[model samples]
Target: MNAIQFITQNTQLDSKSVANTVSLLEEDCTVPFIARYRKERTGNLDELQIGAIVKFKEAFVALEKRKATILKAIEEQDALTPELKSKIEQTVDTTVLEDIYLPFKKSRKTKAEKARKNGLEPLAKIIMAQRTTDLEFTAGKYANANVPDEAAALEGARHIIAEWINERTDIRNQIRTQLEKYAQLETKVIGTKKDDEKAQKYQDYYDWNESLSRCPSHRLLAILRAESEGFIRVKISIDDDRALDSIDRKVIKSNNACADQIAMAVEDAYKRLLLPSLSNEILKQAKEKADEAAIAVFTKNLRQLLLAPPLGEKRILAIDPGFRTGCKLVCLDANGNLLHNETIYPHPPQKQLREASKKIASLVDAYKIEAIAIGNGTASRETENLVKNTPFKRDLEVFVVSEAGASIYSASKIARDEFPNYDVTVRGAVSIGRRLADPLAELVKIDAKSIGVGQYQHDVDQTKLKTALDTVVESCVNSVGVNVNTASESLLSYVSGIGPKLAENIVNHRAENGAFTSREAIKKVPRLGGKAFEQAAGFLRIRDAENPLDDSAVHPESYGIVKQMAKDQGIPLTKIVRNTAVLKNIDLKKYQTETIGLPTLQDILEELEKPGLDRREKAKAFTFDQNIRTIDDLRSGQLLPGIVNNITNFGCFVDVGIKESGLIHVSNLSDSYVSDVNSIVSLHQQVIVKVLEVDIKRKRIQLMLHKG
Candidate 1:
């Protein structure tokens, strides 16, 4: 199939639309660009469908190329027959194809290859035939009377047959499939030799065993970790009776004597070769399963971090709370502009409390600050109290922002570009402030894994976690349209068709030319081709532009259609946008096509209904208990308000005015069966819980959601 036909078949897209989208995507056109500017060509396929078509096309091409390469390699070795070539061509999955190719793959010497070179071919073939005709007579035929005896001849024959059975790919695969289905995984702890302290964490996993198919991801991961630390050894074994029965049924069912000999050979081969190979395969599969679970947790955490409620476009006084080095203070304007910055010594020798309070008050008054964002790091609570009690604007709200990954971003090149004249500490404070204003935009600039959202994030597969997190970020960023005039280069780069360098170029162009008055002005940005504009223009909003629709997510390409709709309805564009009545009167059937479906038309109508509306809701102020700041302060049955720090597959972690959050296990999330934690709570949500238990020495706290 051609690229267009293949994409349509795989993605379930219309043939014409898929063809047009592929043509545009291949020309380096961005998803947003194709959806917006290339509507006529692509039948108005949206960004998401276009992206899927591109991914499908790429994967299809790669698979086709790999198939060709494998076929060529097999042909060069003179092993490619018509049937084999047809099978290779028909195979779709890479793994199955590789499996079929395994025996033919040239490699270093193996036991089977060594036996073949030892002049035992005829003897091996007789043994494989499993003839019932007198075993001694058959054996004597291959015996070299001067060089080898009957017993020696039999031993050599058995070795050769064992090698042959092991090398038979079909038999090996059959046994492997049976073993995988019926295997029991066994784990044994390595006995500690008195002085070994390294194995303490894995002591509980010393004798753990479970069925291969039923083991939990976390439990499997824990066992693997134990093995890695030399605290345990894990092995998977299949029932020998069942395995032997399968082999006998396949090769020696009718002849009793033949069955016995074949069974013995099969047992020998499994013990010497297949068992170890299958063990490694099971372990590999387990590791992948564990990695997928870890990635899922990290992905959820990343999504929560990205979607954390924005503080809106308000002037903020951000303080990176510190005691010894003093707190880093920064003032950001409504549009995230760094208005002023300073260091405040509110704790220690510079404990000039009056002076510090006066400095903060002056800055707040000068900048007309609407809120105070304090980094939830060292001495954060003290800083919050200091700001709250100080003589500043009475209406200014103080919020404790999670400062995770702030340090990473401060030292990044993006930070250096955004604040060339400022120090890293100052830049971090600004980031903290901006994060409160627009969490999705600012957090995208930092590595999602470093944002400190999930459990054991550092121990997971870095590449897989990064790919999943990047997808989540991309989805969230695109879901929320960006402002062309106000978005930072970091946020703009995530826009469809824009990368870091291109984003920088766009920013540089803006800097050189001033604020963009319309989306069309982006065409002037260096290296930004027409394809990029087509994908990116619709999502780039220009507030207060000459065209009112530019402020909405309505694409410029749709401007004419909307204008026509308005004119046909005997209403102006502005009137049609504000009054839903006019839109309700227009006939949407006229806009339907292969590219612009009813979905697109409905979305356009909705955008017109609510022009320039902020999709994100305002985050409410949270209340945390003042008395319970650490585990030592927590007491049983004490009721306290806290913030839901994170929600996981297992439970929710609540930061109930304590250094270490307490987990409300899935069982305890509700009186009823709460299968999913997300159904109950989300990240950064305020919740009330009662301290069910606390061990001050162990630094552990147990919380109960029922109290709330």
Candidate 2:
């Protein structure tokens, strides 16, 4: 099948839609741009659907490339029979194609090759035919200088037959099918390391055996991790007797001495060749499935975290809480620019709570701080208590921001460039403050993996993980429009077509030529051609621009349609923007053209009604249980308010005002079967969970979602 056909079949999308999407992808159109702007051509396919087409299209291309390589290799050897070439060309499954090419594949010398050189192939064929009942007589005829005795000749013939049995596609497929359906993945602890403290984390996997087909992705990844860590040995197995019998039924032709010889060869092939190769292949497929699953979980968590509620532009006091070292505090303006920085020891050896509180209050009043953001890290609880008790002249909202990747951000090159004169602590405080103001903008600076909302992210394929995470970041950044004038280069880079170089050029241009007052002004940036502008224009918002739609999602190309609507209404553009009555009365059917369909027209109308509207919700203040400061103070069934910090395939981790986050397993998420943990809770979701059990020694807490 062609790429369009393959994508249509695999994704179950309409063939026409798949073809159109492929064309757009081939034309270098970004997924977000095509989904948002070119919906009419794609049959209104969403970003996820477009992403699916991209994935399957790449797979088909890879398959075709592999076929060409295989065909060329076989042709070079003059072994490319018409039937074999036809089979290779017709098959799309990579496994089946590899099986067809296995016999022709060049490799190092083997026993079978040695036997063939010893002139034992004729005897092996005769034995395989099963026509001669006297195998010893037949073997003696083939015995020569290389094969000294009848036994040695028969053994050599058996080796050649063994290679033939291994090369038979049907037998290999039979064993592979068995392994896929019935193989058991077993793990056992290394005796010498059983008592090691680190190994205790994976104790549940030690001496464990489960059906490979039935094992969940999380468990399999854990077992693989344990094996990688030298804590255990993993083995994949199936019933050998059953596999041998299946192969025997397929290969053996008659009930005679030749049949016995064939059976022996079958046994040798399975034990020495097929089982090991097919078993590893099956296991690799399982690991791939697990990697995809883990990456999906991480992608979802990262998306939700990136699009988490933004406490829009607000001047604030951000604190990186600590103990004996003192809490590092920075005062940031509404734009998140650090105006001042200082350290105050509210807790620890100094115990200068009065002085710290006074300093914070003075800074809030001095800097006109609108909100107080405290990092939920070391000494978070104590610092929170101090902030709660501090006297302020005006009511201010206080938020505890997740500091998961703050440390990584502190030492990053982006942070250094942004705050060249500040230390790591100051940069960390700025990140916490900026994260509260706009999550999508600030989180894009740090690597998504360091954000800590993943399951086995480091264990999965890093390249795939990075690609998936970057896709999510791009989707989130574009979905919520960026203010082009104020956005950081890191944030701008994720804006559809504006990559690192273009982002740098845009930043440099803005620095040289003031804020972008109109979308047309952006085209002037060096190295930013028309295509980049086309993909990124709608998603880049310009505040107080000459044209009102410049700040909205309405693409500049569609400005004429919007202007005609305003002209038809006999009203100015400003009156049409955000004017619900005018927007509602505007008939979208009148604006639909050959290129602009109902989908694009409807999007334009919505963008007009709420220009530059953020897709994320507004941030709110949440307080955890004051009495529950530590794990030791928790009791069974004690209700507590928490925020989900991380989510995985198995469960989600909730921060409940302590260092150790509690886990709400999939089983405890609901009484019914919970197929997806995300369906019940999301990253940074405020939830009320009851303590089910607490293992203070292990620093583990089990929680159940409270219905109330």
Best by TM-score: 2
What would the per-residue lDDT of candidate 1 be over residues 1-708, giving only the tens digit for each residue? 567767777889889988877777677776655665566677677766876887788778887898899899999999999999989887766657776776676344755554455555576676667665676666566656432665555556565566556666677777778756877778886666223677766666667767877776667777777777677888888887777666656666446544555667677777787678767877688778877877777677677778778989999999998888998889999999998898889887578677778889999999999998988887787787788789765588888888889999999998998899999999999989998888998998998877877765665677767766777787677678888777888888888777788888988898889989988888999999886787777778888888789888787777888888888888777778768767787788897765566666777888898876767777666657766556777778887888877766678888875468798787777889986677788788787887788877657777878543
Spell out the clash pairs found in candidate 2: none
Top-lDDT candidate index: 2
Q: Write the per-residue lDDT of candidate 2 for residues 136-178, one digit (tens) a residue.
A: 9888987788889899998889998999989988888889889
Please give the CA lDDT of all the candidate structures. Answer: 0.77, 0.93
TM-score of every model? 0.89, 0.99
lDDT of 2 at 322: 95
Error of 1 at 56 (Å): 5.9
